[model samples]
Target: MHIGLISILSLVAVVSAWLPSDTDLFGPEPQTNATFSNLSAGKGRVVKKWLPSSGKIRGVNLGSLFVVEPWMASTEWATMGCGSSKSEFDCVMKLGQDAANAAFKAHWARWITETDFDDMASYGLNTVRIPLGYWIDESLVYDSEHFPQGGLAYLDKVVGWAAARNIYVILDLHAAPGAQVAQQPFTGQYAPTTGFYQDYQYDRAYKFLQFITNRIHSNTAYRTVGMLEVLNEPVNGQSSLVNTYYPTAFSKIRETESGLGITDNAKKLHVQFMNKLWGSGDPKSGLKDLSNTAFDNHRYLKWDTSVKVSQAGYIAASCADQVASDGDKPLIVGEWSISPADAVEQSSAFEVKSGSNSGFYTKWWAAQVIAYEKQQGWVFWSWKAQLNGDYRWSYKDAVEKGIIPKDPGQAYNQGVC
Candidate 1:
């Protein structure tokens, strides 16, 4: 579920000594008029809200250096030919570290902070999914037993920054040790794998989650770091990979970290599992084990050219049905993009594109999303990136065309929502 939705459902209102309004990192001036509404009255209560319907579920994936090393370019690393060779892989790793440090020194350390949080808050987005790479804690480096000090320090800053603004953060481990996205870091793609379902890979991933859960759950400051994405885009073409690996890994996470102050519901983890298992139909029986966990899924409806518009209803129904089977665990569409061809097809059965129809698909899909605010919430993929041409798809264009408000500071002020 969108972190905002979770926050709302678990809403708690607090009247603490008001701190100075957080600064804006990159956008216009802050909105002094913005006020916090206490959903509950209590001392030191944490305020949470169901995702807001102020506007479209406009959110972005803060990627690259924040999640992966900017210097670790897929093309550049591939050219280095570091496959399976210890010496070459070491060199690549060093380069990646150097790149991460340099990027942090250059802008990442400054641009991503309370100000950026303020920018996002003003932008009408109620949630931000921060993608994380396993290496940040030094766990992925060959032979390293301890997490990295510098990495944890940087993330701590991120948590404090987001919390001050009342913006919910989803700590997404985008690149696990096996490099959940093989072409990306952490997967040791420089070192190839047998495929996504490797046993050792699942073990390594579980350890990573355990480490992260332990660290985050222990810290009250990071209580706002809602939902841990087991993996990003796992069921793409590798449905078998997730089908084989997710259940086992998910079960281990619950057994290891159940009842931590992290969630209110006990069956949260089970709900997450059944939601992931819903579509295949192999598990015909509904999820017998339910919990407080929400089902996380990503949809790039436009990416699969073969999927027809007529299929949109079925897709939505199937997803909703899966979540409902698990006592209606919150369903969050962690990622999605808009495209015209798909829009045309789904319009008959679902909401059609509107306005100029130029970017009407995005608007239509967003409307459909907003319509479901009470049922579930979503976080769109991506915020800003220097590698616009390669990594960013529609996001880059959307930002430029005013689809995504560029002047982040003025977003909430526009009153469009």
Candidate 2:
């Protein structure tokens, strides 16, 4: 999800020494009698419902943790001397594998912890959308391919914590093998040459999917992980997604689960695809048959430069976003923000400053929440990031600033909408 800019979190106490390795993932599982109240999205549906009975998925993204964005580090990336670098690829290349791994490993360790999960639970938030790079599974990367390894241990620990807090997680493949998009660091690399469409890349991606899917279904620590977003923002090479990738991934994931002796549709993982092919054509254009799936659409009004609408018009826009939910599968707004359009930011009448006392942001937030709930749910772009006071992409800052209410369930702007 592109923002006015780019991610981090805070308030996590040191977790006890428990890291899940390949050996640890399946062994005497950590004694967590976690009641997965949130991860259980629903049961007895061919096309599942990812929303709760009472409300939508009031959630935030751990966007920058696994997929690093240099510009928006919660702590300044420049101070780390990697500021000039555009993405993790540049950082790993510049710092070399070992040095870059140390920096990133440390960042991943401290940026988020159980305390952050507790904080999210306190707000009654139901889900977390975790964006991760394809490189997390080391086997896929070759000698020449430079990507940090040993990330699965951290992922295992984080999802276990989420389970304890009764929060669900959507493990998203943010960056596929050849950098699905040119979005730096976020895509795990600064891939100027988009090669995800190549046959070799698809094979690697399928392997990655099998690896991750098996992990989530088989690992008790990952009980909180409910959805596997097959890909994130596939703006390039769109035809393959519907005609080939989506169908194949659906079969591969289902087959993997079935092989694990999981046959009931209820116990299976829900795969999420882009609500529509982004920079390509319609999602339904050549969509094949798939089951146990949902859709994800990201709406960032911040980039609209055409015409600035009034605050009331913003509510109208949120209320009017029915097209995002037009698909047969359930929809979730994977990313959105309270940030106004570029034109609105420049408007003298709106006074659109980040975390401004202008009730504009609050109303906009509520409007989208109410509207998004009408379909399935929504997850705000990010939980924490570098922008000091701007709540545009930072859900943490928004909640702290009172622009977004601590209890998201309260429809503060429901009357207006």
* Top candidate (TM-score): 2
Candidate 1 versus the native: TM-score?
0.61
Estimate the overall C-alpha local distance difference test score of candidate 1: 0.46
* TM-score for each candidate, following the candidate numbering: 0.61, 0.83
Predicted candidate 2 versus true structure: per-residue lDDT over 128-237, tens digit per residue:
89998888878788677776656777888888798777577888989998887765568888878676876788888888888888777655666657688888887754
Give lDDT tens digits, candidate 1, residues 1-417: 001111232233222211111112112334445433333213355342222212223355665434433342343233334333232224435446455344344444654556666667766565667777555555545553221224566676677667666555666666656444444443334335434456776776677677666555554455455556666555344554445556655665666556443333311222233244334332213323434455655655554454454434434432343223444445666665444343454354333233343333333344435433434556655555433232223344455555554543333343222
- For model 2, give the 10-residue run with minimal summed lDDT: 1-10
Model 2 Cα shift for residue 214 (angstroms): 0.6
The Cα error of candidate 2 at residue 358, in Å, is: 3.2
